[model samples]
Target: MSEPVKKKAVQHLLVWMPNWLGDVVFALPTLQALRKQYPEARLTVVARPPVSEILPCHPDIDCVIPIPTEIGKRALAQMRFAFSLRKYHFDLAVILPNSLRSAWLTLLSGAPRRIGYETDGRNFLLTDPLPVVKESRSIHGSDYFAGIVKPLGIETVDKTYPQLLTPDAIGKQRELLKRMGADPSRNLVIAVAPGASKPEKRWQTERFGILCQKLVKDKDAKILLFGSGGERELLDEVRRFCPGKSAFLLAGLNLQVVAGLLGNCRLLVANDSGLMNFAAMIDTPVVGIFGPGHPKTTDPPIAPERKELVTLNFECSPCRHRFFKECEPSPNKKPFCLEDITVTQVARAVDALLDRLA
Candidate 1:
């Protein structure tokens, strides 16, 4: 035998997933890689309530701890919640977010080896601070996440995309689709999500409706619509613009259930939202619409043959890291960034996807 193998010190790992649903979904590959590297470590994920639902069912995660409050708000609730993490006695903390609050929580959790990117003044909080490389159009999210562990002798990082599949959720998704008049026999299922984290990121709802209608009419594809409770208005706009029996709306379902449903689709056209990441995770082809965000950093890391996605081309693309609460639109003006994107452009993208699928 060569030399005696040194035993790893850590037994419990706490992964601080991103607070936003989309970002949280994007972080799954990192979680999976950690699980593979530390097979015996009790891997726990700490996330907000909505995002928490997706982690529990992941095969890599041993447990999920819901962050008690909106970590986005730097309030007393967040402080108390940070203290609550101390009970887990996490040996390793993986901070995925670039937020100072996330760093503070990792510090308060008392985890000796805190791993994260060196940014947002959070570098001091981390024991293993990886350099945050500045690049445009090449820094994929999965690769960016894996860079942190490069110094720790963990190589051969898995390049697989986000993974999630619960049998019950999958079964329920099938039943729900059937009830919505989607035929399982025909695999020509197409879905569109007319909502994003913000109005700025969202492609025009009318544009989405027109695309759905065209897909139903020309390709006879069964179109389905998805979103959260907040997307009801956009969904209504999709329905109104369609003006016929072309698509079905399935919003506000449990997040995993929605993911499972999206998994069954042949194609998914969505904004740069959590659903886009979820669709990528389930290996569904996607036509992701990007605006007010960096597609280079956040686009689904699937093969080009899977789907042909569309994003707007404006000089003022990617307005903010996170969305603003209520940015007022100008009088006699729509969100021109997304409005500039035409339904014809989206339809062409979808057509290219269909050709690839065929």
Candidate 2:
């Protein structure tokens, strides 16, 4: 609780970052609060691999240690990673994730003070475990993260969106884009991330393909498809529907490359995923396509006026967000929540966001 911070000085602080990209972005404010609470303490963040690649780019963070979140038949990796953290001599560990492994890692790190939300039966592992956040439409994702640091003397968390990429890096990505055949200077670049982490969250790539071509014709925009290496098949599926000259497939590029390009783009249209949160974190205009998850609770609350969400009013529209098994799969096997959303609705949302930006 607040007693630890009030009693002794925090020399080196360990901030265990969330594994999911969206949750990682949401926790930025908590990191900011921690930095403010212990101005001179060494702040370190440990997260999973791909997202871990970009965490060091932020100015507030002093160090980032990459750790494996998956323990599929082997936890030797987690043990080695945890044993590696003990040398840092962290006086306090702020566990962002509610997983038992997260608390166990903090315990293994030999940190004297460990704090996190009391969930996943990991309360016994934490020194100051707070109450778990309640579910409500009014409570935003950022609030859940901000609540984690309140017990540590951080009264008010800064909700300002941090610039994740430097201007030099963002500017350098233009050459990379030009080499890839996209001219952001000549054409208004609209980056599209058609893939989502969860199957229930992604819109049909065929609609995404059609929407890209329409944007090229109607708005004279150049489409840049962003996705990880694993999403090459999905990226290819969307590019197959796009015009040959205008749309470019950018699968398998570095996350920083995508972030830099997102920093320079006119706007980003993505399904409800980490890339959507990434684009918004770097201050890009985002048009997020919502399916089963309602934007009210799932989306970040920062700069609501600058962002737009498009979803239907179906009875099962805002079903249980995580791994939604409630809805019957469509005949084509696509989840009904995402399959029902038409391309026209998405285009209208994109148009409205662009118009507002203009």
Candidate 3:
């Protein structure tokens, strides 16, 4: 029997998702809503290039348009990108990222109904310019992105970020685990992400090393360090301090393979990096060590029992959005924000997770 055709209320819908992994994760709820509303209509996502790789198998989106680099100047890039968007004849465009660039894209897409925050300079381009509530800034990024879609008649539902693990990735992860002598049956497998986008967001390396040692000694867990190319040096520093049969350093793996490996791990202990949010999207329990970034904005939003399992903190945390720029630590060369977070405290959080699992 043939499946009945979905009567299209609107044919095309476009969403401009953020470039960073964590930001993209927050945009998932909006994509899920679009899927529910459109059902069969083509949904295109205008995502930054690095993020484009994940959208091919994304269950929600039909196409991924890479955000082209402006290359020359701001005006030239905007005009070029705007002209480039003329290709997609969209009926309605939902701009998820609140950047003027994103709003401009939606406008240039010439979608009859473009909806986004009114703050960006491209407000004139949007047909439905929704005001960003001052209070909404404090809300979780997941909730913040969800706000833009409400005007599109998109219903709210819990949308954990989506990660597709391929067969090759699974095979590679299994091989790596086996070579590292990771007992597939008994010992707990934990992935530690020791780096963040900005230096301030990073958990103390010594503290992370201590936490790994404690987990291995106490729970007989196997620790694996995961990070991107940029984080290789920091990961190496972590490896130097954490020594024994139970720990392995696995950095610079392809993102998909890392996701696959994380899928099999018992839990992930990470700083406020994209890796932490990636783990949450894959439904892996994550103990996120948040410092310079707001936990409410960056931490996982799945149920407390399952995702965002643990978060380490200090009194004067979240000093800056970027390194020491927006928010800074104290003067006189004394950094108290992440300094107050001790190794013992993180170990306690890990112990609690072990207790819950047992």
lDDT of each: 0.74, 0.82, 0.72
- Single out the weakest 10-residue window by summed lDDT for candidate 3: 1-10
Query: Which residue pairs does candidate 3 place in steric collision?
Result: 319-327, 320-327
Q: Please, what are the lDDT tens digits per residue for candidate 2 over residues 1-358?
A: 7465752468899999988888888888889888888888989998887879888888889998887547543677777778888999999989998899889888999898899998999988998999988663456677888888888767788778666778898889988878877778877889999998876678987889999989988988888889988998898888877766787878877778788888778889999888898788888889988877667656744387778888775675566654436667786566776788899999999988888888
- Candidate achieving higher lDDT, 2 or 3: 2
Per-structure clash totals for the candidates: 1, 0, 2
How does each model score on TM-score? 0.85, 0.93, 0.84
Better of 1 and 2 by lDDT: 2
Extract clashing residue pairs from model 2.
Answer: none
TM-score of 3: 0.84
The clash tally of candidate 3 reads: 2
RMSD of each: 4.4, 2.2, 5.1
What is the C-alpha local distance difference test score of candidate 1?
A: 0.74
User: Candidates sorted by TM-score, descending order?
Assistant: 2, 1, 3
Candidate 1 matches the true fold with a TM-score of 0.85
Output the better candidate (1/3) by lDDT. Answer: 1
